[model samples]
Target chain A: MIEVNYKHKLNNFLLDISFTMPDKGITVLFGPSGSGKTSVLNLMSGLGNDKNKKINSRFIINDRVIDDSINRIKIQPWFRNIAYVFQDHRLFPHMTTKQNILFGYNRCNSELRPEVLIEKFKIKELLEHYPEQLSGGQKQRVSMVRALLSQPELLILDEPLASLDYTSRQELLPYIECIHKELDIPIIYVSHDIKEVLRLADYILIMDKGKIVDQGDIADLCISQPLLTQQEGASFILEARVTKIIEEDKLVQLDCGETILITAESMRLNDKIRVLIHARDVSLCLSPPQDSSILNCVPICVDEIQADENGKLRVIAKIGKQTIVSLISHRSARQLNIKKGKQMYAQFKATAMIK
Target chain B: MIELSPILVTLKLATITTLILLLIGTPLAWWLSNTSSKSKVVIESIVALPLVLPPTVLGFYLLLALSPDGFIGHFWLYISNTPLSFSFSGLVIGSVLYSMPFVVQPLQASFEMVGKPLQQAANTLGANSFDTFKNIVLPLSKRGFLVAITLGFAHTVGEFGVVLMIGGNIPEVTQVLSIIIYDHVEVLEYTQAHYYSIGLLVFSFIVLFVTYSFNRKLMVRL
Candidate 1:
C-alpha cells in the first residue's frame, strides 16, 4: 500500500490530505479541473517540489519511506523509483524509439529485459523511428514502455489518454490494462473522464477543491457517485462473469448473482466484466414481466425507499448480495405500493459493458 | 602575394575564442534559461551590453583592464610575468566579451526551448542532473550549439574595433583577418585590401550559408 499525508497551501485553498491506496490494481484519482489532483500527484512523485516548497508531507510506499518531514528524509526524484508518464508524452525528440525506451533502462540497470517489452508493446517495427514519426497512440505506447523499462517502485499516469482522440484512446486502453495485469507495479492514474474511470479503475479516489471527499472500490462507490458526470444520470457497476455466448443474437450471458445477457459479441466465456446500468433506465414491476421488450428482468428484494429532490422515488433493491437502484415515480410507487423488504422485479435494457 | 601568417593568426584567434566562449557560455546560458533569480535580469543585460554599446567604447575600457597597471592585467602580470595589453591573450579576452551575446542568446533560447518537461521526465527515469544534461539536454540542443558556435566564431573572426584597442596590429602574434584588412587599407594598399576584404566577405557568407542550410535540413528531419 502507498500511504500519503500531505499539507500544502495552494492558490485558493489549503490542501490537507492523508490517505492509503492499495498497492495493486489501478487506483484512479478522479476530480474536476483545478481540484488539486495533479498537485497531489506532484507531491507523491516529488515533481515540481523545488518550486512548490513549504510542503509538509510524508509518504511511504510499501513500507519504504520515500519522504518524511518528521524524520527529515527525502529522496530525490531520480532515486525515488517513482516513474511518471505525462499527458503530452514527453518523449525525447532527438532520440529514436529504441533509444528513448532504453534511456531509463540503461541508467537503472533494470533486470527487466528490453526485448520482451519491445515485443509486448508491439513497437518492434517502429523502434528505429523517431517520436515525431509515430502517431499519437503509438507515441503514448512508446512512452509507456519507456516508463515501465525504468522499473519504478510506483508509476503515476497523469491523464496519459486525455490527449488522444476517441479512436486513439480506445486503442491505447488495452495497453494500459496489460500493464496492471502483467506487472506488479502499482499505478496511480489521474483522470476526470468518467468513461475511462469506469472502464479501468479498480479503486477510486474522488477529489473536489483540494480534498478527497470520497473513495472506495469502483463497484462499491459507483452507485453513490452522482457526480460521475452531469450529463449522464446515476449508474452502477455490476461485477459479472460471462457464462455463455449466443451468437445468433450477438449476446453474451453473464452471471452477476442473477443471469444477464448483454449485446457484446466479442466477450468470451469465463471473461469477467462490469455491466454499467443507469438507474433511470431501470423500472420496477410487482411481478416478473413476461412478453416484454426489455432483455433483463430480475427479481430483487426492496431494501429502502427514499424521496429525491426531483419529486421522484429512488427504490433501492438487492439481487442476491449485489445492490441495484431504480429511479421510479411516486405515482408508480403508490400504484405498486413498494416499500422496504417488498419483492419486485427490476428491468433495464441496453446496458454498457466494460470487459 | 598574400601572406599566410595573418590568416593563420585569425584562424587561431577565432578558434580559441569560440572554444572559450562555448565553455563559459553553455553554463551561463543554461543558468540564465532555468533560473528565476532576481540577478538574472542584471546578468542578461550585462551580457547584452556588447550588442548595444559601441565596440570602440567597450574596447577603450578593455584596453585599460588589459594594461599591466589595470585590474586583470596586474593579476595576469603577477601570475605569469607577462603583460596582457597589445597581446594575443588580450585579443581573445576582448573577443570573448564582445561576442558574448552572439553565443549566449542562441544557447539560452534553445535551452529554454528544450524546457523543464523533458528534464523532469529524465529525472524520473533514473538520470541525475548531469546525466540528464549530457544525455537528454545536450543532444536535443544541438541546433542551439550550432547557432552559438557559428555566431561566436564568425563574430570573433570579424572583430576589428576591440581587437584594435586591446591587441593593436602586431604581425604574426595579434593581427587577425579584420585588423589585417584595416592595416592594408591604412597603407593605401587598395589591391591587397580588396583581396582580403572580398576573402572575408565570401568566407563569412559561405559559413553562414552552410550553417543555415544544415540548420534547415535538421529542422525538416525533426
Candidate 2:
C-alpha cells in the first residue's frame, strides 16, 4: 500500500491530503480542475518541495518505507522505483522513439530490456521516427511503454490521456487496460474526468479544493454519495459478464450477478463489460407493464428517495444487489407512495447501456 | 605579395588568445549563468568593462601593471628578471582581457537557455553532476560554444590599441595582423594596409556569417 500525508501551499491553493491506496489495483485521484491532484503526484515523485512538521509520507512497497519524512529518510526520485508519465508525454524531442524507450531502460537498474516493451505497445513500426511524427495517442502509448520499461514498482499516470481526442482516447484505452491487467505493478492515476475514473479505476479518491472528501471502491463511492451525483445526469455503473449472444435479435444477454437481460449489442460471450446507465434514460413503474416498448425491465426495491432543489426526487433502488438511480417528480413519487422497501419495476431502453 | 611571417604571427596570436579565453571565460560564463548571488551583477559589469572602456585606457593600465616598476610588473620582473611590457606573452594577456565579453556572453546565454530540466532529467538517469554536464549540457550547447570560439578568435584578431600599448609595435614577434595594418597606415603605405584590412574584414565577415547561419539553423531545428 502507498500511504501519503503531507501539506503544502501554492499561491492561493492549500494542499492537505492524506490517503492510502491498495498496492495492486488502479487507484484514481479524481477531482475537478485546480484541485491538488497533480500536486499530490508531484509530491510523491519528489518533484515538489516538502513542507509541514516532519511531513509523514511513505511509499511502502511490501512494508518497506521508500519515503518517510518523520525519519528524515527520503529516497531520491530515481531510486524510488516509481515511473511517471506526464500529461504532456514529456518525450525527448531530440530522440527517436527507439532512443526514448532506451533512455529509460538504459538507466534502469533491473535487467529487463526495452525491446519486448516496444513490441508490446505496438510502436515498433515507428521506432525510427521522432516524437513530432507521432500522433497524440501514439505518443502516449510510447510514453507508457517507456515508463513501464523502467521496471518501476509503481507507475504514476498524471492525466496521460487528457490530451487526446475522443477517437484517440478510444484507441488508447484498451492499451492502458491491458497494461493494468497484465502488469503486476500498481498504478496511481490522476484525472478529473469521472467517465475515465469509472472506466479504469478499481479504487477512487475524490478531492475537493485540496482535501480528499471521499474515497472507496469505485462502484460504492460512485453510487452512494452526492459527489458523483452532481453531474446533472444520473450516473450508475453496471458490471456484467456477457452470458449469451442472441444474434437473431441483434442483442447480448448480460448477467450482472443478479439479473440477466438482453442488451442492444452482440458482445462476445463471457466477456465482462461495464455499462453506464444514465438516470435520464430510466423510467419507473408501480408494477411490470404488460406491453412496453422498452426492452429492459427489472424488479427493484426502493433504497431511498431524496428531493432535489427543483422539488424532483432522485430514487435510489436496489436491483438484487446492484444499485441503480433514477429521477422522478416529487409529487409523482408521493402520489405513488414510493418510499424505502417499495417493490417496483425500473424500465430503460436497451440503447441506454453505453458500451 | 605579403610575407608568410606576419601571417604566422597573426595565426599564433589568434590561437593563443582563443585558447586562453576559452579556458578562463567558459568557467566564468558557467558561473554567471548558474549563480544567484547578489555580487553577480557587479561581476558581470566588471567583465563587460572592456566593451565600453577606450582600448587605449585599458592598454595604459596594462602597460603600467606590466612595466618593471608597476605592481604586477615588479612581481613578474622578480620572477623572470624582465618586465612583461612589450613582450609577446604580454600582448596575449591584453587580447584575452579585451575580448573577454565576446567569449563569455554567448556562453552564458546558452547555458541559461539550457535551463534546469535537462540537468534534472540527467540526474534522475543516474548521472552525477559532472557527468550530467558532460553528457547533456555540453552537447546541447554546442552552438553557443561555436559562437564563443568564433567571436573570441575574430575579436582577438582585430585587437589594436591594447596590443599597441603593451607590444610596442615589434615585428615578427608581438606584431599581429591589426598591428601590421596599423604600421602600413602610419608609413602612408595604403596598398599594404588595404590588403591586410580587406583580409581582416573578409575573415570577420565570414565568422559572423557562419555564426548567424548556424544560429538560424538551430532555431529551425528547435
> Which prediction has the highest lDDT against the true structure?
1
Error of 2 at A291 (Å): 5.0
Instruction: Tell me how far the alpha carbon of residue B99 in candidate 1 is from the true structure, in angstroms, after superposition.
Output: 0.7
Which is the leading candidate under DockQ? 1
The stretch of ten residues in a row with the least summed lDDT in candidate 1 chain A is A223-232
Candidate 2: what lDDT?
0.79
lDDT of 1 by residue, A252-340 (tens): 89899999878886777898888878778899998887789889999999998877667777787898789888888989999999989
Cα lDDT, model 1, residue A261: 75
- What does TM-score give for chain A of every model? 0.92, 0.91
Tell me each candidate's TM-score. Answer: 0.93, 0.85
User: Please, what are the lDDT tens digits per residue for candidate 1 over residues B110-167?
Assistant: 7888889999999999989899999888988888889789878988889888988888
**What fraction of the true interface contacts does model 2 reproduce?**
0.17
Model 2 achieves a DockQ score of 0.33
| lDDT by candidate, in order shown | 0.87, 0.79
DockQ of each candidate relative to the true complex: 0.80, 0.33
